[model samples]
Target: MIALPPELLPQLGEGLWHLFTVFLRVSAMVSLLPAFGERSIPTRVRFGIAVAFTMIVTPAVPALFAQPNLLAMVRLVLTEVLIGMALGLSLRLFVLALQTTGSIAAQATSLSQILGPAAADPVPAMGHLLTLAGLTVAVLLGLHVRVAQFLIHSYTFFPIGTAPLAQGLSQWGVQQIARSFGLAFALAMPFVIASLIYNLALGVINRAMPQLMVAFVGAPAITFAGLFLLFAGAPLILSVWSDALITFILNPLEPPR
Candidate 1:
């Protein structure tokens, strides 16, 4: 790459700084993402991916960085980063919700002990399955393409250097995040309900036959039932989760007032 003259260095600096903001936002999203953002991936690789994303994104949003003043430029760049992070994280939150369902399922079905790749924080067996399913669906549905489309459309609506977001949008975002918990629970409810009934039956059996090793017998029974339910319900559960993901991605961007 040909180096710019010393006088133009300042302008170059500004552009690169703007790009760094994009990097920050994209990196934050990648950090939280399902497969690409997992802890198992090396930090260097993540940084590289962020740089590549920044390069791809910076050109599309150049109008946002036309301000020549340093402070204004800084503010614009920060805004870009925030917007990118918010967009990326909004998509990521669904994956987190799926993992939440998995965690609940694993605990309920006594399958938490099964070892698996540590996805985020500490992952359980169900967490792995959920993450895998979500990732698969995301990839299959071309989430990357849809996300890019959303980002592009966001510029048409919100534009760069737009005013700060309204309190209502922020509040709405918080509500969306809060709703994910309920969505996750709904996905995991079948397994949870099955486990509850199975455990209740075991308790009744123990009371009715004090001498029997209900605990030992109940273990296999619950495990088998849980596995069977998981196999039966995985398809429908994934469908619901995928629909939720699409709805979220299609929501309009909230421009700052």
Candidate 2:
């Protein structure tokens, strides 16, 4: 072991403390980050990812130099965790939007029951597909790089050892929830419209030919239409979802347009 000089010792200790503080925030955020924070990923791998992110983010953020007492340290831990979680949840909402869109589309198209149990989560097949595809596209589009920049930029808004105001935080949370649901509905609009038209046509046909079994005829038609729409519209749906996600990453607190 190499002995460090007294002057270098203090600097080394400060560097370690800074690293530890940044790691606390990073690890908390990584627990809910898009690709890195999935339930399927091992805990150890996630931990390693958090460490890697800390290394990348540390250089960009200003160092926290104040020495913390026991109480202050506890406060710091809670504050960092809260801020990290808030940031992580904001990003996670985009994933939730994709899932919600899929669920809405599936239900509208009468495909909700098909392959509902395929994923670990209790979402429908369409939800699983959209969620998986959205995540894949996000990762492909340099989500990791954007995340690093997000982490670094977060420090500007939420500085070290400071807690966000509760009222403002609550307002932001509500806005994000509203925006996500609106986005989901918008993306699933095509399926909803198709379903409405199919139902109206089926009702008219049933009225015109009372002897015919319209349910049997309409069921297959709706199913086929749903599959065809999914095949044709998935690219556009994913594109819109990706753009929304990128916008949020670029400016998280912006109100929905």
Question: What TM-score goes with each of the models?
Answer: 0.79, 0.98
Q: Candidate 2, residues 1-257: lDDT per residue as tens digits?
A: 98878899878888998998899899999999988999999999999999999999999888877679999999999999999999999888888888898899999989999975777777889989999999999999999999999999899889998899999999999999899899999999999999999999999999999999999989999999999999999999999999999999899878988
Residue 92 CA error for candidate 1 (Å)?
Answer: 1.8
For candidate 1, give the lDDT of residue 119: 57
Native-vs-model 2 lDDT?
Answer: 0.92
Q: Give the alpha carbon lDDT tens digit for every residue of 164-241 in model 1.
A: 467855875787677678888899998889888988898899999999999898899888887888889888988988
Q: lDDT of all predictions, in order shown?
A: 0.74, 0.92
Q: Which candidate leads the pack in lDDT?
A: 2
After superposition, which runs of candidate 2 have C-alpha atoms over 4 Å from their true positions? none
Count steric clashes of candidate 1: 0
What does the lDDT read for residue 41 in candidate 1? 84
Clashing pairs in model 2, backbone N/Cα/C closer than 3 A: none
